[model samples]
Target: MRQTLLATSLLGLSAIMPAYAADYVIDTEKAHAFIDFRIQHLGYSWMSGRFNDFSGTFSYDAEKPEASKVDVDIDVTSVDTNFAERDKHLRERFLETDKFPKASFKSTSFKQQDDGSLMVTGDFTLHGVTHELSFPVQKVGEGADPWGGYRAGFVGETEFTISDYGINVDMLGPSSQVVYLTLSIEGIKQ
Candidate 1:
């Protein structure tokens, strides 16, 4: 009878506790990040480019926003535009990825906004320059996957000028260009 009571108490405690703790680290294989940008092509038409290889991790708990944190890293040399010539020019001249291979972001805090979304304000580094950036983020949803891993998804977007990153513009023949970044990060809770 005593063994049965102890087992019951342990089961009750397990039920009350989360399957995974809030400190659960994010698994990057189940995540994604995309950067979208447009630049004028000799004042004719706009050219769009995107980077392909990027990685990030986040610890999120809806009940504990204060404990949430995120860190992201983007490979600047992975810039792609579907054109080899243009991509080559961008990596060699525009972004200078050889000198600055990776851009990163580390969040200072996460706040819940009026609309029930989240705002992550952090220092974003690009081209060896650091800039303050705040992005609006929404928790898409969380659920169990058929493969038996838990998943959480989020969406965030932010925009800034290319010149802010110290990139030369004479090649593009413009003083500045609007660079837009969109993040869709999905994490698998281990």
Candidate 2:
């Protein structure tokens, strides 16, 4: 009788334990994650730039998406717009890498759409200011990598006013306030 009572108590305890979610670490070495942005230049064409270094980690399960989370860190000094001179000016005048050398995003919630898409809402910090941002994310691909690590990829795009991040729109001289951003991330399972 004592053995049965102990077994029942153990099972009951296990059932009441809070469930934990599986997590994956960002493959900083081979993530191939890209953070690219574009802004209108001088009221004419757009100037595009990409950051070369960043890292992130996330937990996701298609069946249990509510438990998912994401955190990403980007290096501001790695911004590359192809033109060396402009890139320098961007880091110094606009981004001010010396003052704020890093930018980051951390997910707060996830809402699944009827169309099988996800709306991940999070806090995005840039230029030393934090703001709420949401992006529509879609599963791009998923499978095993050539290196034997399992992987999953996703794409998210959003546009926001650069001025909202405390950037000067006039110093750049009549540039558009809205900036287009896209993220392509491939995370490896840990």
Candidate 3:
């Protein structure tokens, strides 16, 4: 929620002003923030997985939405697809987790769209390659928690291809190269 600051006037009137922005750190353990993805499998079904470990921090300003910032760090080896053998293949052959164990995102700019959604442009790093990318993020909601802390949530959606990051997809054969992602994030007010 946005808090309005009051600017007093000599006329006994008051003016509303933008609330100062605050930094919010992701309480990964409590928030259950997750990085989930879906990709075509065998040309007949969609394979889904999620990274179980990640952390991030972001600043939010409801009154000045453009001033928001975001940064995330993902543990590549934490990828979980529910199958032990497949997970091993993803870590060893596909991701090469030994050489590049981390993936990350750093925001460059924030833009609010006409539809009240946000366009976050940032550098996304995966498989040791970094590239500029933009994605849509929507504020889920914000409120006080039972623990006396305030939390805010957002959902982000983006897509990319393994080829774009120099990952070999020979095993997939004719499967779709694109990987679709759905990100759920919750930040606790610091």
Candidate 4:
């Protein structure tokens, strides 16, 4: 019958079409995300800090992980090192927060690895300079919430030298040249 043939054709078309990717907003209002950094302090210890203000969005397709994309913007002036004096020095001399108030990352590609993690490559802008950076990101989890909402979480870590972004690394000492950054993101489905 024509009805049966139409039904079969519709089902075939649906199977061939790509699944819709979900768009999510980073849950900053709930404080469920964080951007943290750590760097060696004079070759003896590590200094840890975090940025308090940031927002981002991401689109993820479970069926097509390679099509995922992410974009984040951070308020550079929101850096907190837990030390007022050191934080002030960092804002003024190191980061020059007044001159460059924002840093951002926009993903260019997301490649799924054999281990199920993603190798994310993107353009990272910091201190008025942009560079291509790549890092491994792992999906922590994704599911429906008790409150009738959906959420997904991911964590990624990468390191870069301060001098690469035009920041003066002399004061940080030789051992403190590189800064390690960690991004813990939890996004609510939009």
Clashes of each: 0, 0, 0, 0
TM-score of candidate 1 against the unseen true structure: 0.80
Query: Tens digit of lDDT per residue, candidate 4, span 65-86?
Result: 8999999999999999999999
The digit string of per-residue lDDT tens for model 1 on 114-176 reads 998898999999999999999889988888878887888888888888788897567556523
**Candidate 1 ranges with C-alpha deviation above 4 Å:** 1-33, 39-46, 171-176
Better of 2 and 3 by lDDT: 3
Sort by TM-score, top down from the best: 4, 3, 2, 1
Itemize residue pairs with steric clashes in candidate 1. none
- lDDT top scorer: 4
Evaluate residue 72 in candidate 4 and report its C-alpha lDDT on the 0 to 100 scale: 100
Q: Residue 89 lDDT in model 1?
A: 86
* lDDT (10s digit) by residue, model 3, range 141-175: 99899899898999999999888887976676557
User: Better model by TM-score, 2 or 3?
Assistant: 3
Strongest candidate by TM-score: 4
The per-residue C-alpha lDDT of model 2 at residue 119 equals 93
- Give the per-residue lDDT digits (tens) of candidate 2, residues 48-120: 9998999989888876777789999999999999999999998998888999999999999988988887899
Q: What is the lDDT, from 0 to 100, of the residue 104 in candidate 4? A: 100
What is candidate 4's local distance difference test score? Answer: 0.95
lDDT of each: 0.79, 0.86, 0.88, 0.95
- Count of clashing pairs, candidate 1: 0
